[model samples]
Structure formats: C-alpha cells, structure tokens
Target: MKNYDVVIVGACTAGTYFAHLLAKEGLKVLVIDKDSEQNLCKRLDIFHFTRDSYDQFDIPVSGDGDAEWVHDFDLCLSKSALDNHPKKSHTKVAVMHLPLFIKRLRERAISAGVEFHFEESFVDVVYNDQKQVCGITTTKGYYDARLVVDASGIPSVVRRKIEDDYIESFEITPRDKFYVLLKYVQLNNPDDKVELSTSWPYYKGWIAPQHNKSGAIIGVGANISYDYAYKCMDKFEKAIKLPEYTLQYEEKGCTPYCRPPLSFVTDGFMVIGDAACLTKPWNGEGIPSAWVQCTPAAKVVAKALSDGKIATKEDLWDINVLYQRGEGAEYAGTRAMLIGAVNMSAKDNDYLFANDIVFCDDDKGPNPNVVGTLLKGVFSGKFSLGGLISLMSASNKGEKLKKHYQKYPESPAGYHKWAKTALKLWKKVGTMADTVKDA
Candidate 1:
C-alpha cells in the first residue's frame, strides 16, 4: 500500500487547506477528491471571507478579492420599529471568487510537494489491530497513512464509518439544512453593494456585487426543499424589483445550518470542516469557519507529529479543547440563541425585529448573541420589560452552553461524562424551524 504522513479523504477547502499547511511544514501529505480537477468547487455561492482572515492564513489574494475593500451591507426587516424596524450594520466583510481561491490553494499545496488524487471516492477506513485508524481504501485503490482526516463535507463518510465505540458521531438532520439558490444577473440598480433581509425561520435573500461589476449575484436561502427555495428566489427577485436582469449563471445547493460537534477527535483520526458542522450561526456561511476550525487542527496535528508521535486520541484531544474554548464555544451558544429567537411566536419575533432586538446585523459579522448591544437596543427602542426578559433569557441559555463547551474534557478520561452533560443541556436548546414559514 502507498503511504504518507496524512491521508485526507476529501480535498475541499478544509482538507486541501490543512493538507497544504502540513506539507509546508515538510510533512508528506496526500489529498483525494471524488470530483475532477477542472470541476473542483463547482458549487458556487455569493460568499465573502474576511480580509483579516486572508492575511491571518497568509493565502495570497488575487482578482476581485484584491479590488477595493468594500463593507456596504444594508439589512432590511420584514417589520418596522414603531411604524418602523431595526437594522443592523456589519463590519470587516469582503468578497472573493471561491473557485479561483480554492484553485490557488490546491496549486500552493502541490507546490509544497503534496500528492493529489482526484476523481477517487472514499470507500472505507482501514484499521490497525488496536482499533486505530491506519489508512483508508478509496475507489481508486488502497493506501496507508499514519493519520486519516475526514473532510468530506456534511456527509462525513469516514465519520459515518466509525463503529460508534469511539467518538460519538455528529449527524445533520433535514432540519439542519438550508436549501439555497444563487444566480449571477445583470443588474439595473446603480448601487454597487450587497444586502440581505429576511424574516425568521422562513425567507432570506441577498445581493452581492460581482467582481466584474457588470452585474451582481443575488440569492435566496430557505428552510424548505430545493424546489421551494427555487421558487422562493422568484419572490426575492420580485421583492427587490430586480429590473429584468439577465441570468448569466445559477447554482442550487444546500448548506448544513447546524452547530459543530462538541468533540470530533479520536485516536489516529480527525474530522473537520463541514463534516464537523462549523458554519457560522447567522448566515450559515461555511468558508470562514472552515478555515478557522481547520487552522487550529493543523497546528495541533503539526505539534503532535513534531514529537515523532502518532496522533492518538489523547494527542489530538487538544483540538476539541481549544476549539470549544474558542470558535466552537461561541458557535454553540450563538446557534442556541438564534434557534431560540426563530422559534419565538411570530408576534414576538416581529416585535423583536421591529425594535431591532435581534438579527439586526449581517450573519457574517462578529458574535450572533450581542447581549449588551441587544439589551441597550431593547431598553431604548421598545422599553418593554417582557422584551428585556426575553433577550436576557436567550442570553442566559447561550452562556450556559458556552460554559459547558469550555469544560470539554482534557482527554478521553472524562469525555463520556462531559458529552452526556453537554447533550442533556443541548436537548433543551434547539429550534422549531421545522414548523415555520413566511408568515
């Protein structure tokens, strides 16, 4: 069997990005993808990753990402703040051509002497006698690796194959997906900016200016089926008076709109990116969180190997601990807080939004649960004690989940007890979006 220091089962952003990081550190890396080279990153979205993040990762920026920095985000509400509604502005947001960005990453990885295998789907996980992951068998063939990483998006093929005796698998249900449609169109609006507006648990739409500036890419994100979301786009097009723009191209897909697992590490294996459910809480953006989550993973894996040690569960446990204390913790709390908001009665939601109490900012912006700002906004605009209490209650639940996440066990020694407690707490913190629609 061919061997390498690492075998990444999915060569998407998380897998390839992390593979490049490792290879740059002088590690032997192998990245495999089921899709062909030309069609990589085929699913396109009108998404923007942060400028700060690009510099943080040291990934070179080319094309429109190199254009003038723009942060003009206009958020409209379905309801009004008196006879009006509250609006939230965003910060530190920018756009990039995703397929090109990924291609650059892939090429950079290849330059670092990393091996690439495309059009080969993962078949199964190979294991050693001690029940540790030793390698993986792909549709193309079999290869051995010291560590196996599952970056195969939400399906998480390698994670699904885990016998359940190891780490508890995190699965995405139907309720955890957002059926989305994005289209590039020739616009008539002279304004060269993007905007997103929606009502909770129902309809959301956005418009992002294309790099060429000839037109823009507008999209609809919905909690319904692909067909329903497809139809919803027509409504969004009508909502904005989309000016009979010609459709240049379009993409319809789904994103996992769920919180990541409390822990996703085990002996000789790691699961990351969408497979770990690291999308941002507000807009369900996956790119930034994928990079954020995987950066720490690369560092942890690098350190684990630096000592000439195999990445056992204990060695990799820090990945969970650090993320829980950082991005994972914030994401879990934000998710609960958001689900709490969406599950509110429409009247309550209308009151909150009309008062600018929640969902006032772009989803890609900072924290979703902005307790102090929300408290002030409620105090000044609505001045209703019930509103104040509702905001506080959501804040409290978010804090509780964050605390639980901070207490993630140092090793497998206390994982069961910790995981049990975390699950019990999460059971109290989901949404009723399954029943919501544009009302």
Candidate 2:
C-alpha cells in the first residue's frame, strides 16, 4: 500500500493547478480522475482566465494575442448594448482553448513530480477509527493519504459519502442547476463582441469568438432541463449567423448551483472546484472562480504542511473563512439580487434594456443606484409600481445576506451558529416563479 501526502480526485484546471502548487512545495501528490488520459476534459466550449488572474495562477499564455479582451451585451445587433460588463481590469480576459490549457497545467504538475492515476473511479472515503478521512478507495484499489481533495464536480462521490453535518447542503435542487450547450460555429467577422442575450432572466445565450478569428463558441445557459436547454440552444442558433467557413465542434454539460459551503475543510479532507460549488452564481462561470477559490486553499494547506502540522479541520478552516469573505460572499450576494430579476417577463425585461435602467451602457454594469433609477421611472410613469417594489425587496434581501456572509466565523466553534443564521436568511429568498408575479 502506497501513501501520498495529498490525493486530488479531479484532473480539471483547479485540481491540476492545486497539485502543481502542492508538488512544488515538495509534497508527494497524486492526481486521479475517472476520465482516460487522452479523453480528459473533452470540453469544446471556450473557458476564460480573466485579467490579473494569469499572474496569480502562473499559467503560460499563448502570446498569439489569443488572450484578448471580451465584452458582453444584452442585444448587440439591436444596438442596445445593455450589459453587466466586467470591470476595466477584468474587461480583457484570457479567452482559452480549455483542452489545451488544461493539458499544459497537467504537464506542469507532472514535471513537478505529481503522480497521475487515470481512469480510476472514486468509490468512497477510507476512514480510520478516529472517524477521520484517512484515504480514498477507487476502482483500482485503496491508497492512503494524509489529505484528500475532492474536485470531482457536483456529484462529488467522495464528498457525498461524508457525514451530512459536515457540509452546508447535501444536494442541489434541479432548479438550482444550470444546463449549458456550446457549439463552435464559424464567424464572418472575427472582431465581434461576445454577445449575451439575457432575454430570459435565468436563461441566456452567448457568442464568444475564437481569438484567432477563425470561429466562435456560441452557447446557451438555462436552469431548465437538458432537453429544454438543447431546444433553447437550437432556437438560439437561428438568431446567429450560421457557419460561413466551418463548424468546428459542439459540447454540453450541466452544473449544480449549491450555495458554497460555509466550510470546505473537515477532518483530514478538503474539497475544491465544482465539488465545493465554487462557481459564480450569476453567469455560472466556474473556471476562473475555481482557480481563485482553490489558490487560497492551496496556501492554507501548504502552511499546515510547512509548520509540520497535520491538515486537520481546524488547520484547514482558514480556506473556508478567506473564501467566504471574498469571492464566495460576492457570489452569494449576486444570487440574492438575481432571484427577482430572473422571474420578470420578457417584455418587462426588455423595458429595462430599452430605457438603459438596469444594464447600463456606461462602463459600470448596472447603475450604482439602480433601485433609485427604477423609482424615478415609476414617478414618470415609465415603470410600474409593482416592478419598483420587487426590485427594492430583492435588493434589500441581498444586502442582508451579504452582511451575513461577511460575518462568517473565524473558527469552528462559531460556524454552526453563523451557518444557522445564513441558512435562515437564505430561506427568505424565494424562487423566481414564487417571488415575481406574472406581469
């Protein structure tokens, strides 16, 4: 039986990057994935690593100017470019070919002496008499490790086996899942802006160009089922210009939207990436977020190992604390603000776009005082009173949650009490259909 200092159960970007970081510290790391080496991360859609993130992750860039700035829009062709645009610093992101990008990270990890275990399905956690995770059992066999990192995505085979009390949410409802489809299509003009049509509050279609101007990944995201997503994507294709030169590829996947756990660390274990639900709730963008979320985790883990201390729950708790105070909190607040907006009818949404009330054409996404703008419109008889009330209520609810997240505890002793407060506030958030009356 071989034992490693750390075992990572996913080969995606976050998992591979963490392995590289850990191995660089001279830790004996093992990375396992159910996917075969040749078929790993077979995603055809484009992924992004936003600006200021490249240096943070230390990822090598193509330098072909392939890493270009991208923009989002409500309706580009209609000339109503209302949007939730990235800040100026984040405006230009590294538009990546995810398969190649992941390959580079994997090879880097391998060079740093991280071992690979491919085509092995994780069965369950191997626990010691102390009721702590001691190792992981996989299809091939059982291997002991001082720490196990579960990045196996939302299904989270290893995480699911853990006792319920350890996690924030046991499962994500179907309504909380986002179904996505991306098809690579040729573009007549390569200089086109990345288009996002938020015609549906919870569902949006996007057009992202390949940096080489050769083609683009056109995609649609919805909380609906896979069948409905495919149907929506099909209808969405007709709106875009069809392939003029070549249609390169197409892909589809689904991800759940659980609130990020209050804590990702437990006795001898930590979870990252989709398994930990590190995705941004707004756009369902997990790639860059996963990178950011796991980077803090790696630092905390390294600190424990460097001090010659075991990676116990207490030692690893900072991973959760730091993230909860940062991006995790941001995502929580954003989700809170979106519930009411998502339920609005298409016509009412169009009114916001037409008036430049919500998606500001200016550099900022929405106006800083968006609710104020809505009220002024109400006075002018441009917007309805009911709409004004909904936005105000949603905004207030979101603020309450953000403050609660900012109050996340510093230690386990205060965690459940804080989490109980969080869960209570969370329940105050109603479903889109339930919260918003039909217009």
Candidate 3:
C-alpha cells in the first residue's frame, strides 16, 4: 500500500524524459519497466531529439568533436544541395545513443530522489468507485499513486483498463504497419566515421554509429500491409545485403506510426510516450513529438494537481485539446498528407527521390542523400499529386463526394478537413479486414 506522487510505467526514451522532468519538479516519482536493467541500458538505436531542445533540458551537447550530437544537414547534404528548402530543413536535430541517453536521464531523476524499479510488469490498473484510475497492480504489488503515467507503449495497460469510450477519447487508432529493425551491425570500415545515408532502402531507415566502432543499419517502410511485411522483411535483409561484419546485437519491433489518442490524461492519471501513442503517424518518429508534446502535458498535470482539482477524463479531454493546438495538430495534419500520398499510388516513392520541380543541387555538388532530395521537393511544393489522387480514389466514393462538397470554401481549410475525414473513413474500411480469420 505504498503511495507515490507519480508512477511511470515504461522507462524507454519518452518515459525517461517524462520521469526526469517530473522528478526535477520535486514530484516523488517511481519508474517501472518490464525489461531487465541491462537490456534497457543497452538500447543503442539512434533516437532523435530536436536541436534547441538541449537548451530546454539543460543538457549540453557532447563536447567531444567526434561526439557531436547536432549535425547541420546543410553542411553535409550532398555535393549538390538545393538553394531553398522546406522550413523542416533548417531544423537541427540531435540523434542519441538512446540507451545511454536514457540512463543519464534516469540517473538524474534518481539523484533528484526518484525511485527506480526494474523487472516489474504492470499487470492491472486500479480504479476507484468513480471509475477514475487510482494506480496500478504490478507483479511486485499493488502500488497506489496520486497519479499514474502509462508509458507502456502501444498495447497500453492503463488504456485497456478504461472503458472503450474512455479509450477512444482521442478518436485515433493504429494503422497496419510495423517496423522490424536490425540493430548494431559493424561495417567493414569500422574505422570510418558514420554519416547519414538514405541509400540503404526499405523506405530508408538510418545508419547510427556507436562509440565501440560499430554502427546500426536500420530500414523502414509504409503502405505494405502488416502480414506482407514479414515477407517484405525477408527481402529487406537481402536488399541491404547486411554485412558479415555487422553483428546483430538486437532486433526490435516498432509501430510504423502511431495514431495516438489526442489527449492522454484521465481522472487522476496521465499517459506519455508510446502508451499515449505519441508516435508519428507516418515515419514512426516518436521522439520529436514526444519531447515537443511533454512540456504541455506536464504543465496541465502539474496545474491540475496544485489547483486541488481532481483530474478527470473531462479534464483529460481538455488536455488533449491543448495538445492538438500545438505540434499534435501539425502531426495529425502531416499524417493525413502522407497517407494521402500513399493512397495515390503503391508505386509512388516520390519521397525517395528528387523530382524535376525542386531539382536544385547544393552549391558543392549533388549529395546523394535523401534529405537533400526531400528538402528540394518540399521547398518547391512538388508533392506527389499522383499519390494524392490515388489516396482519394481508394476512399469510398461517398467520402470523395463529401470532400468535393466542401471544396467551395474560400480557403484551403475544406481540403484539409476533407482529407482528414477521408483518412478516417478509409481506416474504417480496413477494420472490416481485421475481422477475417487467418487460415
């Protein structure tokens, strides 16, 4: 019957960040995870944190000239780079060795008096008579807290505990793509420095290096159904021609993108990171949105607690409203855009290459990097029209007609709204497929 101010389930990247932030504010925090401590610490994949973020968190970039966390895409994009790029281009990003990075955050939280519990799984969620989440029942014991933060990832325990209506508060759901990644492969040129290379295919993941002279080769893709992805995965290994020098330390699973609940707080409880589905809906990039969105979530939670207002699902709805106003809205919009592109044509891989509209190369030369190409396209506003048409066509004819009906608005709002509505409608179409049994 021990009680804490806050109990955080799942100590992964976003969970680590949330705990550290909450603990720093003098909240009594306990972080629990099902994974072994060593396994959690050994996660070495490149998790990105946006630039300007280090200043927010008070963590300095690594001073080691070689340990640079922030890299200027402009400096290294290609021999040929574009003159103008999308606003997303100038945004500097920090890519970290997630395990070590998380360890540092955890250490800081611990120093600030946060408790850590490992190898414990949260088996059930506790609810009071009001149907508000009170705490969690874990393998170790039933721990009560004034607030519970479920960062347990997509298959969320706290979310499951709530009624289905409560679960669907944000009106979002999962898509059919999952990412199977190969981690920690040493290349033949172990001595060589790691550079960004999108040429390695399968929707182009990433090449992340470790201090131990080893690196990881990652790949990602969308538009492929989940069942087909297993076969596609076999082909991915073959496509990459995974080097013999590449030692497979770990293979990991991730949702290709998560359509997170718009708001994650409910009566006396809140969720963060994957538990809330704070993942990107298109590229599976959860780290940026997680960090960007956490500050607001924390603010609301802290405010509710200090104001002596019992957090309620209605309050959670308000919090979701707050989130949707910021990066959350942009993420939703971006997802709609990408899904529209995907539905345009299965063969359309416009994001993978530079098009004629935005063909400007870097002053130096054509840097075969994908960012270079992507930036060029973004600046030119040369999105895949074919993709747009294809996506709309795939939706029910009724949905398409609804969009057309809205097309007469003076501005572009109608288009965006129509696209969002159509995306939801299309998702409903796929749900029927989910009911079909596997042979």
lDDT of each: 0.71, 0.70, 0.55
* Candidate 3 local lDDT, 329-364, one digit each (tens): 555544544443333221234342234211223342
Q: Please tell me which predicted candidate would have the highest lDDT against the true structure.
A: 1
Q: Which scores greater on lDDT, model 1 or model 2? A: 1
Writing each residue's lDDT as its tens digit, candidate 1 over 380-423 gives 66344555565567668888999888777888788888878888
Candidate 3 C-alpha RMSD relative to the actual structure: 8.1
Largest TM-score belongs to which candidate? 2
TM-score of 3: 0.70
Model 3 lDDT vs. the true structure? Answer: 0.55
lDDT of 2: 0.70
TM-score of each: 0.83, 0.85, 0.70
Extract clashing residue pairs from model 1. 80-84, 80-85, 81-84, 81-85, 88-360, 267-313
lDDT of 2 by residue, 1-439 (tens): 6888899898986689889989987888999999998888875436655655677777765545343233322222222113322222124455666777788788888999999998998888888877778888899998888889988887777777787465653665556677787777676665543443222232366665554455667677766477777776675555444345456676788776657777788877888888887887656778778878777777788877675434778888888788888787777877777775655544455556655554444454556667677777778876677766766777788888888888778888898898888888888875432442321
Give candidate 1 regions above 4 Å deviation: 63-92, 189-202, 212-214, 231-248, 307-309, 344-356, 359-393, 435-439
